[model samples]
Target: MPTFTINGISATVPDGTTILAAAIRIGVEIPHYCYHPKLSIAGNCRMCLVEVEKFPKLQIACNTVVTEGMVVRTDTEKIRKAVTGVLELMLIHHPVDCPICDQAGECGLQNYYMKYGLHKSRYDLEDKVRKKKVQDIGGMIVLDAERCILCSRCIRFLREVSKTCEMEFFQRGDHSEISIFPGRKLDNYYTGNLADICPVGALTNKDFRFKCRVWFLSSFDSVCTGCANGCNVLADFKGDILYRLKPRRNDAVNQTWMCDFGRLEYRKANEARLLVPVLRENGKAAAAAWEGVLSTTALRLRDIADNEGPDAVAVIASPRSSNEELFLAKKLAAEVLKTENIGFTSRTPGDRTSDDFLIKGDKNPNSTGAQLLGITEEGFGRVVKAISDRKIRALLVFGSELSDFPDSQVEALLSNVPFVAQVGTNEGVVSRVANAVLPSASFAERGGTFTNFTGRVQRFSQGFPPRGKAMNEIEILAGLANRMGADWKFDGEASVFRALAASSAPFAGMSYESLGSEGQVVAEGRK
Candidate 1:
């Protein structure tokens, strides 16, 4: 351990810890750029200057390792002047268009200007060096050369992290700018991270360029359900609309980076949605009230199980649902529906290709949770065979899992099955095939936990309310369970998780309080 004094505060940190990191640990702020913890240090940005005792000149805090008994001063008059000078030099050639830049409220230059550099401009707009602006760089990113601060964070990220060396510095000194090399452009699925690492408006996301201001959007900690990797994210929304999902730092999962596919998954909560419950009438589907839908659904399932047999009913749970929701679904099938013939569909309905970085090939976030809750993935074919044989008197399907089946086969099963009910988030094949369609909430509209591919259980909160007459899976399942003569009660997701922890052996002793922002991995040593 290295003990040091920073701004008159004594602190001890691990060996090789930088002054900037030590300051951050002790609740001190040292302004910096181009010094991301994940990327290699480029020491070009001298904004984190600090005064070390017995040293003639100030040193940059980012690359300055703290030695034992070393004295550091970050809040001195000398540091303030040095930082101000560095900020002025960086801003001399930068554009003054913060009003139009999409990174307005969150830009590093805009924030540092208010803190350090308020000096009157010594050079006018015409006197500053000019560079290219609004160059359409490949991979959903727009580049403005005039606003780049020559930080080289984006350039280094490509060379080191993504291993796709497409961007580089063009000229020398003030005329230098970031650009893709000739005859090549960014063609990777991880290009969206370039905008996140850039400290200024040089690289902006084309999908979210002018949509909404950062000040108007509120952020909530969430886990991405795009795949089994379960990358952490910050859901940015306003009112009932989710604008974006930015990567949240989780060292065990996605460390401050997510693929482009996961970034756009938020659109499912905002567009082409199902709003109300629809009941089949005279071979036609019609929008109906929740009360009638629940009662009718319960009556049909109960009468069939009592008449034909427990094996006459089948359930197709979804891996896209949460742990609590899946537990309730399994309970609804075993206790109320009284059938061991319950399973979830294994084949997903997306681009199943994955990379070595952050994406997973399963394309489902909760398959591990579904399996832990006693739902088999191999029974989809058996359930389909039962429906084909006309032995399934009543069928319950969650999500649009049937949509991934062959259209001719799906239609034949829907026609042969006596009664079909679906709980879906959006209108797709289920709207046409199922005899009754119940609207359920998307991932962003409900709060629950999802177990990733490695058996790591993470918690995500609801960012949007259920649109129109839609309800979450827990509420809808509980309603049907009670209507079917099964006594069930749950206050919220917390209570449901508590119930899940008690019943499931793998998730024996865990709660929402224990699984805070960063989640706890399931399996061994989880007390």
Candidate 2:
């Protein structure tokens, strides 16, 4: 440990911690733009200047590591003046477009300008640098050269993080601007990150352009359902409309970034979502209420179990579901419905390694969560074998587009099940085979937690209402279990999580409240 004084307050931190981080720890904020916690130190923006005792001049706090008995002052008059000067210099080339800019509300430049740049400009506004506008950087990102401060944050992000050196600074001096290599585009897996780190409106997301104003968009702490990595996120929405998705900081999971696929998954809610619960009775589909669906499904399940025994009833769980939902599905099969035939499905085929970056080979969100509950892909195969052997009659399937299976083995298993009850948001192969399809909420519309590949349990809250009358999968499962006259130990999603945490040795002391927005990683033996 190293002891240092930040703005007159003395404290001890890890040896390699930077001065800016120390200031943040002590609540003395130093304004910065290009210094991201997850990225390498760039020291390009002089906004983080701090006066150090015994040093000849002010040092960039982000690049300057704290040493034993080092003294740093960020709120001194000299430091503030230096930071103000840097801000003024940065704004000389920056366009005055905050009113129409996408990053106005949450931009680093805007925040820093208000905090450190209160002085009226003595520089001639007519002499400010002006360049091209609305230049397409790639499929998703659009660039406005006039608004760029040339901090080189985006350029450094592409080269260092994405390792895709597609972005570079072109030209020289006042004409220098961020551009891609000849004939290359910023079409990497994590290209959406540029929009998040732009500091200003120099780069904007084409998909999120002209959408709802960010201030009107309310945010919900959530997790990405796009992959098994389960990256933490904040879903921004207003009323029933979803606006955008932003990454929440989680050092154990995705760090400070999420994949483009996870970011664009919001558009999925705008189309083909099951808004209301529907029950097909006597070959006629009719709209139903929550009570009607649960009561009816419970009776039907009981009838099947009485006639065909527990072995004849099968339950299929989705990796897309939360740990609570999957655990409830299992309980419905083994306790309420009295069935041992349970299956867990995932879409990742055979790939399951982590790249140590954004893209995880496992495509589903909670495959490891299912594994924690003792449900594996191989366990699902046993159910398929039973279906093929004509031993299973009634099947309750969760998520996955069944139509994608056209002529596959899984399709054959589903087709053979006489009473196929499908519960999910999308209508696909399961819809074609099911006699009853209960509309369930998508990840965005529900509040739940998922365990990622690394056994890190994360929670995501509801961003918006379900499309129509759709119920959360956890709520639906719990409701059905209640209607079946079975004593369910849990009621709310958080309540069930206690049992999940208690039963699973890995997550022994974990709770929904403990997870909070940041989440916790399950240790080796504990997980």
lDDT of 2 by residue, 1-527 (tens): 99988867999999899998888877888888878887788888888898889999999999999999998888889988888999888777777888989877888888888888987777787887668899887857998888887778888888788888787788888777777787877778787888888888889998898787788888888888788888888888888877788788888777888888789877766667777777776657777776777777778788888887888888888888898898888878888888878878675443354567877877788888888887777768788789888888787888845313443655666767767788988766566556677888888888888888888888888777788888888778877887878767566788888887787777788888998776777867754
lDDT of candidates 1 onward, in order: 0.87, 0.80
Per-residue error (Å), model 2, residue 516: 4.5
| Residue 131 displacement (Å), model 2 | 1.9
Stretches off by above 4 angstroms in model 2 are 122-126, 348-356, 407-415, 516-518, 521-527
* Best of the candidates, lDDT: 1
Q: Quick one: how many clashes does candidate 2 have?
A: 3
Q: What is the lDDT of residue 312 in candidate 2?
A: 85
Cα error, residue 153 of model 1, in Å, equals 0.9
Per-residue error (Å), model 2, residue 284:
3.0
| Each model's backbone clash number | 0, 3
Residue 10 displacement in candidate 1 (angstroms): 1.9
Clashing pairs in 2: 403-429, 506-526, 506-527
Worst 10 residues of 2 by lDDT: 400-409
